[model samples]
Target: MTHRTLFLTGAAIALVATAGLGFGLGRLTDKTPAAAEGHAEEADHEENFIALSVADAAKAGVLTTTVGRGGGSELVLPGRVALAVNALAALGAPVSGAVERVHVAVGDHVSAGAAIASLRGAEGANARASVDVAAAGARAAAAAAARDRRLFEAGVVARQDWEASQAAADKAQAELRAARAQVTAQGTPSAGGLATLRAPIAGIITRVDVRVGAFLTQGGLVAEIADQSAVEYVFDAPPASVGAIKVGDEVLVQRPDGGEDSARIVAVAPSAVDAGAAVVRAKPTAPAPRIGSIVSARVILAKGAGGLTVPADAVQTLEGRAVVFVVEPKGFRATPVITGRAAEGAVEILKGLNGGETIAGKGAFRLKAELGKGEAGHED
Candidate 1:
């Protein structure tokens, strides 16, 4: 073959190959639409399939709500029950004496002016003897004064003599009065030579420091009596809670026996202990368990006027801020929230959420993971 004919054949073969490739590409482009339609149908069927993966379903978890209440905050403090000073009585001996006999034992309830013990001592005995002697002297002075007065009135005695007699009688009467008071103070008259230690107040004898035959001083304590009808609970609270706790605020006393009692804040200490802790006192209406008994108290700092609140765990940290996930039709969304004081395992959401929004109550962390997965799948 000639060189020109060879070149032309080669060129023709190249052109045929190019044409065949273009035809094959065009056919491929035409079939692609049908293939794409099949894919679209499969996707439509998948969209109807509501089956969520185990992980995705787990991410949904349970739902819960939060509410806002009118309470400031609650401060729980450990405390102990004590006798109100006004209700406590300390029985003391008016004179030095040996306790001849104890009429009351510990835990014995008594009334005001009730005899708790009898004291036999030299001072009490001397006071009784002086009272007897003064009584006789007073009688003699009275008779003499009366005779003098009659004589002066009858003009048988001088005015000066009658006046002097009157003065002497007045002195004698004063002496007798002093002696009687001393005898009475020792709790003895002629009733017996011994002085009886009377209860200073109406209450139960919580403590007995004296027994029969125990010698006690004039100012020595005989017994401690406390009214068992009412008690006081004293607790120390943080200084931050000072303003929150008010006089007459409700208090709850937790007994060690698994029972609860109610009380009201009677006094809030003006000063703070440990710089940041204030002493709060409450009066319990229930029977006084015992003096110096340990108890727990819950002081209500605020009350419920009721708005919205959510579980504390439901709020999570996102981008260095507090947030909660609200399930939206599109997916789970992170909602920023303004949180308030948390109490009772829940937190107050001051803002960012309205009531009736479904929140992931159980597994919020799992929801975050599923959301990340959905985003990744979209990118793919």
Candidate 2:
């Protein structure tokens, strides 16, 4: 064969080989199983079933409760336990002085008239001197008045002079009475011009601003006492929530420690505060939390027509929808729900649930986390 003919044969052979290689690659791609198997695994993960044995569930604190009927929606607002305005007593220095002694520390229970501190100052000295001088002047005026009466009766002095002496005696006696009142209001005085600071009302001392030997200016805070017995829960409710809450509605105060107390709405401000929130006050039905405790306040706006309800904690948010895990024989299934008003520590389920169904209560979040883990594992 000629050289040109040989070259054509070689080129035709090369083209055939390339076509065969392309066909082989297509067959191999169709046989691969990884992508199909991965998709199947993801479909299974989306089911989100959490399986736990009875013992395991108990260990995980997975609690369940039956659905019931309830009414009302709770408007949970942030609040704090504070001393009632009428029950707060702030003790300040009646006059500038150096604190000579401190008899009590913060948290000390004190009764009315109990001595809290002692202060030595020139003001106390001046207050005492005024009382002594007034008393001496009163005595002299009384003696003069008596002599004037005798002189007028015996005709030894003119009637006008006797009358003038009697009027002066009356004015001096008035000054003495006023000075004595001033001494009583200034509190008990001791030696070295020290004035004892006394509690004006029975309460627990919540603050102490003065220490032994601390110099306090006039009107400076010495201590603060609060009567916890009449404590109030104060809430700053958002403007949108203020309209839902009204006086006489019941409120639930939740402590930071997960404890709860009952309260009744006593007052709602007509306008918002500087923070653009309305101030609400509630009186606790049970013993109040310690003063200055920040807490959660849930106010019941209104009780709607009776409907199916579950424990508030039973509901969890999943995939942007509220869901409750319905307990099954082998595992719990997350069921989406349409919820309505919530009240009395319970939530109203408007749809996706029927009465008498057992559902996860307090520890439902564990199941949600477990489901999330499964999805994340499949994604990897």
Best-matching candidate per lDDT: 2
Pairs with backbone N, CA or C atoms under 3 Å apart (clashes), candidate 1:
66-308, 66-309, 66-310, 67-308, 67-309, 68-307, 68-308, 70-305, 71-303, 72-302
Please write out the lDDT profile of model 1 over residues 105-180, one tens digit for every residue. Answer: 9989899999888888888778888878888888888888889989999999998988888888888889999998
TM-score of each: 0.55, 0.55
lDDT of 2 by residue, 253-339 (tens): 898889988999999985545567889999989888787899987777646655678998899999988999988887788898767
Any runs in candidate 1 off by more than 4 Å, and if so which? Answer: 1-69, 72-74, 156-167, 189-192, 211-214, 255-260, 271-276, 288-294, 301-341, 344-380
Q: Each prediction's Cα lDDT score? A: 0.74, 0.82
Model 1 worst lDDT window (10 residues): 45-54
What does each candidate score in C-alpha RMSD? 14.5, 14.4
